[model samples]
Target: MKASDQTLPLQNGETLDILFRSHPRARRLKLRYDSVRRAAVVTLPPGVSEKSGLDFARRNSDWLQEQQKAFAGQEFLSPDNFISFLGHDHLILHQPDDAGRVRREDGRIIVGGPAGGFEVRLLNWLKKQARIRLEQAVEEKTGLLGVTCHKIRIGDPGSRWGSCSSRKTLSFSWRLIMTPATVFDYVVAHEVAHLREMNHSPAFWREVDRLVDHATISRRWLRQHGPQLMALQICGKSPAD
Candidate 1:
């Protein structure tokens, strides 16, 4: 546990991790679950006491545990299980063959490989797909913004869909490929805009809007469902039985 983090005891007897964040412009105490950190975040407005924040978290410990339970109950990546691909639910199907490639067929994701490596293969394929899409989007956006990206990387990041480094490298969550094309494109535009404006000032937001359409709708969708994307896990096989 970091020195800045605290622990809260849940009604279910689990010790929930709490990360306190102090924001200068925060209007009130807010609590949220951090899917990547597997902890609860308590945002403290400028004048709030740490003790008061802890008490607030205690008051909502049940809500925090509910989030933990929801993610814990998330199923693995296996046959017959549904997964979102390009903003659509696709059933996972296992093909009995070694070294067969993963492919989409008739709106389903077909995995052709040993059952033991099914999850690994499927995840790798998804990463590849994410990289391909991000690379294409980045190339297009950078050109429009008259900027150059140092590198492009795809991975599972906590609480952020995309980031642009000072070095000009761009990082994105592979799970974004599962979201709608507009959502994915908006994230790409967001990071690309950062290549020119490093802060979230009005200028940066203007650049984001200049790059993509339906910016408001995309932002709203992510705020509501980003956690659901992070909650995805490849647990023990739920292969077709």
Candidate 2:
């Protein structure tokens, strides 16, 4: 049965979730086995019956088994895992000594100057600096584009370096702080372009080009180097961890 046709209590080992959209269309049944959570979620249309969803999962049992196998041997680090930032590889020093400097050496953030709590202190300072630089880039380019943005926020995002929401808010990944100045400008320009053109249309590209001529180069840099920034293995994991 289609996921949209049932409404009943879920059985053991099954969790229910429904994603509703204003643009109603064909109902889909997604049985995702989350290895990290160690459970299976049967996502169906709202007001759907649990018996049919369970049956659907049973029918796809082989596929789910394959997925679990794929998740095997995946490495998940704890908060204390060592990470390499910029180009420097270092341990996550939680015990602050208060005798270190936040330096940009080669490509890593060096936090061991005179400070004892180097990791926490360095992360805090870097986040602040990143916010400042991102806000400046956004302001400078948004003016050029003649578009007013809602608000600028900085956080660690797993997937994208930056995102433009329908609410007109622009959020940037904190990892951008590790990249060169050019990549930072490109991301800001890209998000600002969304203000004028909400969608990724030709007009949006035109606006981005006007602000940053080498937008494509910066984009390529993200696709290549962005993942490395995320690899800089400091502890304190995000939700995805």
Candidate 3:
């Protein structure tokens, strides 16, 4: 299920939903935040009932609330906060005196600019990276499929990541840049495949598989984490702020 589908109410009327699933090897009920997926997860042991797991969740509401708060505005790019780049977290460092352009070094995004406009600089840098990679992937995948993509446009759309127009123009979310290259490639391949077959028919899927191996893995990754990327505010002020 998508992250937006279900929500659990926490303190301050916040709803950062927790994911509950059963695990055969679990020895007991377990509740912890999945940093990679950015959600609270509860695991029920073989004999533990779902009711017990939920009660365990509610019993620890205080900790859960803290997690929710930490994750809420954590996506805002600022000094001392890490931002996603190439599917990895890069610490944001503002070197105001340097007066250099944005660059990467030692698992950090080094920004040499005034602190107030620091995030805006990083935002533009990330978008440029998105365009370069998306275009390259589209060109390669379309060539393999023996099709043509008229144009490629990159932007940040809240829900949809990528789309194919009837005119053969392809649009993709700049947020895809935050994910691993494999995930980015999967989205491009999916859209380029649409150039050959508009509908998501079996033939269309077959075309996608031909362009990208292990398509299922990439699809699952997106469904699990895409919403988080959508919720992540790159530039604008957070709703809570």
Candidate 4:
């Protein structure tokens, strides 16, 4: 059976929706803000009571509200909005004559498609660019590290920029294409380094440093600005959510 959902009253006099869930391996109650639904989710351990979960959420209500406020300013992708593409601001242009083609010119991303499908088309184009660029970076880094990868894939995972499985397949968030080139290379290098040292030990970081210069700065940049990149709504859906 599913757990019941509840509501918590915020200090602002607004009530936020809270969903209670039971997790078998959860050691304690955990609360997280769901940016997409703009709700709170409380996870209870297998034997924990819903009352306990609600109490935990109530204790963290202030924190949850802050997170909601932080995400309130997320930008939605649209024809009228400008996006940071490859570290540059690009105006979104819709050209009917170029309906299926996606290109960049004059500091703008020109899309040829029906107005209704512009966001989707632009998203698809960004994904293509991400795959192309990330794959190239992966190939170079893997070659330098004397490692081989099985394949490269692009995704929009909520919690991570990139991941490398034991199968040697590397996966990355297509949103990386929206960040600066250095940031993009840092993520690629970080994942490729995993091929050598699967864990984030000193040796793994050493490999990443060898692959990309100013990696620490790149990491800090991501830590500060990644949310902005994730906040870019694609096809009316926020990437981080």
Q: What TM-score fits each model?
A: 0.80, 0.58, 0.68, 0.76
User: How do these models rank on lDDT, best leading?
Assistant: 1, 4, 3, 2
Give Cα-based local distance difference scores for all models: 0.83, 0.61, 0.76, 0.81
124-163 per-residue lDDT for model 1 (tens digits): 8888899999999999999998999999988876556888
Candidate 4 ranges with C-alpha deviation above 4 Å:
1-67, 238-241
Candidate 3, residue 37: lDDT: 58
Clashes of 3: 0
Q: Is candidate 1 or candidate 3 better by lDDT?
A: 1
Predicted candidate 4 versus true structure: per-residue lDDT over 144-176, tens digit per residue: 999999989888875368989889999898989
Clashing pairs in 1: 76-235
Q: Name the regions of candidate 3 deviating beyond 4 angstroms.
A: 1-74, 235-241
Please give the lDDT score at residue 9 for candidate 3: 68
Angstrom error of the Cα, residue 220, model 1: value is 1.2
In candidate 3, which residue pairs get closer than 3 Å at backbone N, Cα or C atoms, i.e. clash?
none
- Per-residue lDDT over 1-241 for candidate 2, one digit per residue giving the tens place of the 0 to 100 score: 2223322223334333322222122256556554334345566565665665677776766555544444443332222444443324444433334355555444334465543344455667667778888888888888887778889888765546788877889998776766777888888888899888876679889988999888988888775655446544334333221
CA lDDT, candidate 1, residue 205 = 96
Which numbered prediction scores highest in lDDT against the true structure?
Answer: 1
Question: What ranges in model 2 sit over 4 Å off?
Answer: 1-108, 112-117, 236-241
How much RMSD separates candidate 1 from the native structure?
4.7
Residue 132 in model 4: lDDT? 88
